[model samples]
Target: MSPSVTDHVVGRALSWADIPRLVELEGRLFADDAWSAPTWWAELAARPRRDYVALESDGELVGYAGLDLAGEVADVMTIAVAPEAQGRGLGGELLALMASRAREAGAAYLLLEVRDDNAGAKALYARAGFEVVTVRRRYYQPGDVDALVMRLRLRDERDGVGDTNG
Candidate 1:
């Protein structure tokens, strides 16, 4: 089924104050590999190079995503939507926001890694024009799940053309 817009979802920059709630959400969403509060602090410490945005619905946090930029490349560090909020297009909206932010930061391509078993996330990335580049064997620990590396060539802000790096 096609995803539908989540009109109540609003996006905003994630800050230090949100770490506690983010940690709680992380535990709920990712039990084994959930990021620690200290890790989130360190990621936020990276400043303009690392950007994180949180999504809220009716004033309650429902999703969050992070991007790491370096020169012409941008990596989607993490993205998650609450169980109750999944399939409502919040993930795509956050991803698109990251892509726009990456393009504005002069990124030519955006990259991400997803577990092979995550068919939903893989489909989401595929629908967003991302192509699988390679697979890292046993990338996810504790379960030995393979990681599918995906890339999306962002449109050049100046020329309105996609970057020529596959």
Candidate 2:
């Protein structure tokens, strides 16, 4: 990813003061299945290994995402873009940022579990260099859908090639 595109928006650790608006975006994008306010707070505050970021456009938050880094492994926890901002490459941008953070933290691999039904999210991760590693049965609630576990190696490096991570 190029820094030029990153300049259009800014990402920073989520602040407790931004919780209300963050909840609003999460509710709108994830419906009732979104993680609770307390969860976000803990990830942003209590968890030293977790990295939570909010993507803002024009001074208003349009998306949010977070990753949990464990040693040389990182797991993408949540990523949601406002419906209005969908299809603008924001998801990819957010993933790139998270992956970059993962690499900078010395992670050798990144993992994510996506709903089997969410092809859009799966595609984004694939394009970012992730591959399906396994599946979890009846992972999501309200509809017993399975979850696809995907993995991407961050150790691959080739000069002049665009590494998926921003």
Candidate 3:
């Protein structure tokens, strides 16, 4: 069952203490390309430039996301929700939080790469105003899935309108 807005969902900046759970969830969600604990520690070491957020319900981590901010572009490194929490808008919420953090850090655009076969994630990105900018062939190992690179303009180029409300 999907969680509703009234569910006891709580979101906050991810910290070192959450790395273990995040790694466990990562392995479960992306067995083939799961990041190792050392990699996650490196990411966290990067600090403010690489922002991450975690979502919890009933004191259990249910979702997490990370963004890499570089100059005017912010690339979404990862976003995942527990399988049991899939259809409850948690992914969208995480994306929004990442975008907001990126914008605050002066990013002008947000970018992400999704497996070509992930129709649901692709649909969500599309609904969130991301446009397919390019494709990287055989991006994912093991399965050898192609990657759809998507970009979302975070600011109106003409008027410099930013996504402060994200």
Candidate 4:
């Protein structure tokens, strides 16, 4: 069953055990230069990725994303929605939920990297209040693909967001 309209989409916290699915999705989405299972293993084993969550729908894993909560900033270390799940608004929903989690952690801003050629993801971030802040060349090795750095400012209680102290 779906969450209530006011409840927002829910993502299941994933463990290293979910590595197989994560790696599989990464390969399907990134093709030849995908992040290996070990990369995700490292992420899952890390403290920050402990909060990473996978979005499930129709009893299947349709998307996955993570947040690294550092003192006052949250980083979107990795996020991927399965090919069959792309084009749906699920990515944007997952982003919004991640941003909300950052805010809940007292993070003032969120940062992430997106492949420069990913216009769809860029647009998704833009609509979510993120802006292109910088660019890193040859960030994706082997393919020499560039990465666009982006950030989103989290809304505070003063900004009419959920009460920071509440």
Best by TM-score: 3
Q: Give lDDT: candidate 2, residue 90.
A: 86
Count of steric clashes across candidates, in order: 0, 0, 0, 0
Q: State the displacement of the C-alpha of residue 63, model 3, in Å, after optimal TM-score superposition.
A: 0.4
lDDT by residue (tens digit), candidate 3, 31-136: 6889888999999999878888888887888998899989899999999998878887878888888788888788899999999998989998998889999999
Query: What's the CA RMSD for each of the models?
Result: 3.5, 3.7, 1.9, 4.3
Best by lDDT: 1
At residue 165, candidate 2 shows an lDDT of 48
Query: Can you write out model 1's per-residue Cα lDDT over 22-86, one digit (the tens) per residue?
Result: 99989998867899999999999997889898898778888999999997899999999988888
lDDT of 4 by residue, 64-86 (tens): 88889886778997778887667
TM-score of each: 0.89, 0.87, 0.91, 0.82
Better-scoring candidate (TM-score), 2 or 3: 3
- Lowest summed lDDT window (length 10), candidate 1: 1-10
> lDDT of candidate 3 vs native?
0.85
Model 4: which ten-residue window has the lowest total lDDT? 1-10
Query: In model 4, what is the error at residue 40, expressed in angstroms?
Result: 1.8
- Candidate 1 has which clashing residue pairs, if any? none
